[model samples]
Target: MTLTTDTPYALSAPPASLSEPLEGSLKVDIALVGAGFSGAIAALMLARRGVSVALIEAAEVGHGGSGRNHGQCIPVFGYLDEKTLPPEGFVLLRDSGRKVFKTIEELGIACEPVQKGWLNAAHDAAGLERARAAHAKYAGLGKAGAFLGPDEVEALSGVRGYLGGWVHRDGGHLNPLAYVRGLAGAAQAAGAALHVRTPLTAISRQGGRWLLKTPRGDISARAVGLTVNAYGDAAIPPRLRRSLVPMRSYAIASAPLKPDQRRAVLPGGVNFSDTRRDPMFFRVDESGRIITGGLVELRRGRLGGPTVAQAGRRLARLYPELEGLGFTHHWSGMVGISARQRPAIFEINEGLWALAGYSGRGVPTTMALGRALAATLVDRAEGARLWPHDAPGRIPAAALIGFGVQSLRGPLNKLRDRV
Candidate 1:
C-alpha cells in the first residue's frame, strides 16, 4: 500500500487503487474528504451498507494530527468541568464520550486499547481544590476510579509535583495510528474506493450530487462528508472553519527504561497530565518507554521538533527521579481546538456533512463522531438528530494568536514558579 493523505497512518502506503494516479473523472454514491478515523469509519459504514464511496486524501492518511497525536484514549470529558463549558454542554460531552468508548469495545478493533482511565494531577494548592470540585460535578455521572489527595497522587504517579489527582476509570490509551488504519482497511473491505494523494480542490453540488474536484481527479456523489479539520485549505462550510483552531504541541519518547526505572517513574504504567490550560501529558509506552509531551510555544514557528534535552528538562522538573534518563525520539503535530473547545458534527447542505474540532481530545471523540456520521448517512431520517445542523462560524486568527500564546507559555510557567 502506498500511503497518501487520504489513507490511515498505520499503512505505510495506500492500498493499490488509491496509490495510482487517477485516470479521469469518477463517480460514486458518496465522496469523502480526509482519511483519518472519522472519514475512514464513515467510509466503512457507508460501504458496508452497499454505498459506492470514494475517499480523497491530500497527504498520506494519519500523517496529520490523527497519526501525530499523543496516543491517549481519554474519554473522561475533561472539558465538562471547565469554566468554559456550558452546563448542558458538559452533560452532552460526557454522555457522548461514554457512548463512543462503548462502541469501540463492542467493535473489538484490538488496537491495544486499555480502559484504565486518566489522572488529572493538580500541581498546586489551587489545583487540588479544582480537582475536588471536578470530582463533585462528575460523581453523578458514575464514572470509574477514585479522586485522590496529594499523597495518593504521589504514590500513583511517583512524582511529587502533583498535589492531588482525579482518576476516571473509563479513560485509557492505545496506538492511534493502528486504530485509524484499521478503520481504513475495514472501509476498503466494505467496497469503498479509497484514493490517496488526491486533494479535494472544490466541493459543490451539481444536478443533486456533490461533485468534489481533486488535484488528480474528480468524484461526483449523491452526498459528501468533509472531515479535513486542521488542513482546512479547501473552501469548507463556513461554520466548520469558525469552529476549529489549529494549535501545535510537541512530544518526546525516552528509550525503554529498565523495569525498576519504569516502575519508579509510572508505577502502573498509567497516562497522566497536569491541570493547565496548556498542559503537559505523558504516559509509558507498551515497551516501557516514558513518553512525555507539553505545550512548546517556543517552537511553534520553526520546523523541527523540540530537542530531547528540552523534553528531558521538562520531565525532570515534573519527575525529578528521571533527571538522568535519555530520550529516544521527538515530534510535533497540530490539534484542532474550537473557540468553545468542543467537538461539532452537523450537515452543511442537504446531503453534505462534517465532523471536526475535538480540541485536544480527538481519539475517542473522532471514533464516536465518525460512526455516528455513518449511521446518519444510512438513515437520513435520523441525520438531523444524530448530528444537528448548526450555523457555521469562522475560526479566529489562531495561527497568529497561537504564536503569541506559545511564546508566553514559558514565561508564564516561570512566573508561576516564583509565585
Candidate 2:
C-alpha cells in the first residue's frame, strides 16, 4: 500500500482488497448501500441465510468512519440528546460488542483485538461524580463497569491528574479498518456480491421492487438498506441525510514512544477517554505509538491543524514524560451527529431501511445493529425484537452545519463543559 499522510495508522499493514465494481446490471434479494460495518455484517448474514444480496460501496470497505474511528469498542451509548432511551435500544447496546468480538474470533480476522478494557478517567471531583453516574447507569443494565478511584485510574493509564475513573472490562479497542475489510471479504466468500467504487446515484420504486441506479447500471432489488450513516449521498431520501449533523473528528498517532515512555503512558493497552463532553481519548497501537484524537477545526474544506496540536499539548499535560514526541499520522473523518445523539434504524419508505448516526459507538454497536437489520430484511421477527428504532427527525439548523456551525463545535463543546 502506498503510504499517504492521510492514511490512518490503524491500517499500517497492507490491506485486504475489497471487490471492484460490478460490470452489468444485476438484481438481488436485498441491496445494501455502504459496505462499512452495518452493510458488511448485513450482507454476510443475509448471504449465509440463503438470500442473494449485493453489498455496494462508493469507496472501499471501511472507507468512511468505520475505518477512521478512534478504535474504542465500548458497548455503551454516549452523547444522546435524549432524556430517556427506549428499552430495546439498551438491550442492543449491551449486546453489541460481544457480537463484534464473536465474529472476530469466528472469522479469525487479524484486527488486533485488545480485551484489556476501557478507562473513563475523570479530570476532577465533579467529573468523578459524572463518571460514577455513567458507570452506575450501565451497571443497572447488567453491565460489569467498575468504578475506579484516583490510584486505580493513575495505575491503569500510567498518567496523573485523574481524580477517578471507571473501567468497563467488557469493552476494548481494535484496528477498525482491518475488521471492516475482513468482514467485507468474509461476506464475499459467503456468497454476497460485494462491490466497491460503485455508488447508488438514485433510487425509486418500480412496480413491487426498488430500482437502484448506479454509475455502473440500474439494479433492481426486492429490498434496499442504506447503511451509509454520515456518508449518505443524493441516492437516499433528503430526510435521511438531513437528520444528521456531520461533525468533524480528527485523530493522530505519535511516532513510536520509547520503551520507557510506552511503559508510562497507556501501558495497559486499554482505551482511555476522559469525562469532558469534548472528551480526549487515546489508545496504544501494536507499534507502541500513542493513538489519540480530538475535534477538527476546519477552514475552507481543509484541516486548520490546531486540533491535532491541541491534542498533543493535552497529552503532554496528562503524561509529561512524552512531552516532545511528534505525531506520525494525523487524519480527520466526519462523525454523524444524530438529532437525538444515538444510532438508529430508519424506514425511508416501505421495504427501504437506513442505519445511521452512531455518535461515537459505531465499532461495537454496528455489528449487532447490522445483524438485526439483515435478520429483519429476511423477515425474521428476532431483528424487530432486537432493535426497535425511533422515527427520524431533522436537526434544527442542520443547514447551518454546512455554514459555520461545524467549525463552532469545538468552542461550543468546550464552552458547554465549562458551564
Candidate 3:
C-alpha cells in the first residue's frame, strides 16, 4: 500500500468518530480546545476533580500529530534540562513514562503501552560525553537508568557504530491514537463533555466568562485551555499559530519483518535513537515492523507531502535485516517549536491559556504537564509550580529561520560526527 498523509501506518484503521459539533450555546467552568493528548488528559483530570469541563476538538481525537508519531514513550527530555524545568516539573519529566503507563493501567486504556527500555546512543566523542553526563543526571533521578558500553550497545541493539549510551527501563512505546481515544472516552465518562469537529473561530471575554465562537454554536466558559499546538493553525486563532514555529516530523515504517528479522534489531526490547544533530531513531513495534524517521521540512508547512528517501537509507544503516527492506508506509506530522525548547503553558490572556510546543517529545511530556495545567486552572497558586505559565511570544521570521535550520541539519550532523 502507498504511504499517506491523512492516514498514517500507525493509525491505518478508521478511528471511532468522536462527538458531533457544538449545536447550541453551552456554559461550563472550563473549556479546552484540541482533543489530542494534552487536552484529553487535562479534561480528564478536571472532570475527575468535579470541575465542569468541555473538550472541544477541530477533528476527532488524536487526528493531529498525537496519532501520527512513531509512538515511542520516551520519559526524559533531551532539550529540557533541570535548570530549564522547575523541581516539581523535573520530577514529573523524570518519571514521565511510568506516570503515563500508570494512568493507562488505572483507566484501562487499550493503547498497547510497553516498557522494555529506551536508549539515547552516542555516535562520536562529543556525543559520548553528552550521553555520559545525561546518564548521570538520569541516574540521580532513578535506579532504572543505566549506562552501556559501545560493545554492549552493539550487542543489545543490532546497530553498530555507537560509542556509548544510556537506557531507562521505564520508557518504551505505545499506540498513541488509541491512547488519545481512550483518554477522551474516560474524560467523557467522568462528565467532561467532548465535542468533535468543533473548531474555535473566535474567543473574547463576554461578561465575566470567555465566549468561544464555533462554526455551529458559541460556548461561554470561565477559562479556556488551548492545546491545539501545530494542528491548531486553522482551528485556532492566527495569533496562536504565529506563536509557534511549525515543523513536520516524518516517519517511515518497513514491511512487517519476520520473527527472526525482528529479533535481530532492538532485541533487548530497547528503542534506539542516536546522538546527532539530525538524529536517526528506530524501534521494533509490536507488529514486528521497524519504525523510524525524523526529518523536518525546509519551512513551516505540512505533514502530507512526501516521505524523505533518507529515512529508508538510515533504517538500513542500523539493522542488516532491514537492508533493502521495502517500506510499507510513510507519514508525517507537524510539531510546534517553542521559544525555550521546553513545555510551557502560555497565558494568552486572563483566563485564556495555551499549552503547547513540546517540539517532538509530546507523547511522554504532555501527560505529565497536562495534570499540572488542570490543577492551576482550579487553584490560582501564588508561586511557581510544575506547570510554568508564560506570556506568548511569536518567533520573528519563523518560517525563514525554520528553513535555515532544516537546510543546515544534514551538514551540521556530518560535521558534528567528525568532531
Q: Per-residue lDDT for 145 in model 3?
A: 52
Give lDDT tens digits, candidate 3, residues 105-177.
Answer: 9988777678877888898888898888878877876735568998889887887789988887778887778
What overall lDDT goes with each candidate model? 0.68, 0.78, 0.77
The most accurate candidate by TM-score is 3
> TM-score for all predictions?
0.83, 0.91, 0.91
Score candidate 2 by TM-score against the native.
0.91
Candidate 2 all-Cα RMSD:
3.1
- lDDT by residue (tens digit), candidate 2, 164-205: 888776688888888888898999999999889898888999
Question: Regarding lDDT, does 1 or 2 come out ahead?
Answer: 2
Those runs of model 2 whose alpha carbons end farther than 4 Å from true positions after fitting are 1-4, 10-14, 78-89, 298-305, 380-382, 402-405, 413-419
Cα error of candidate 3 at position 288, Å: 1.4
Greater-lDDT candidate between 1 and 3: 3
Better of 1 and 3 by TM-score: 3
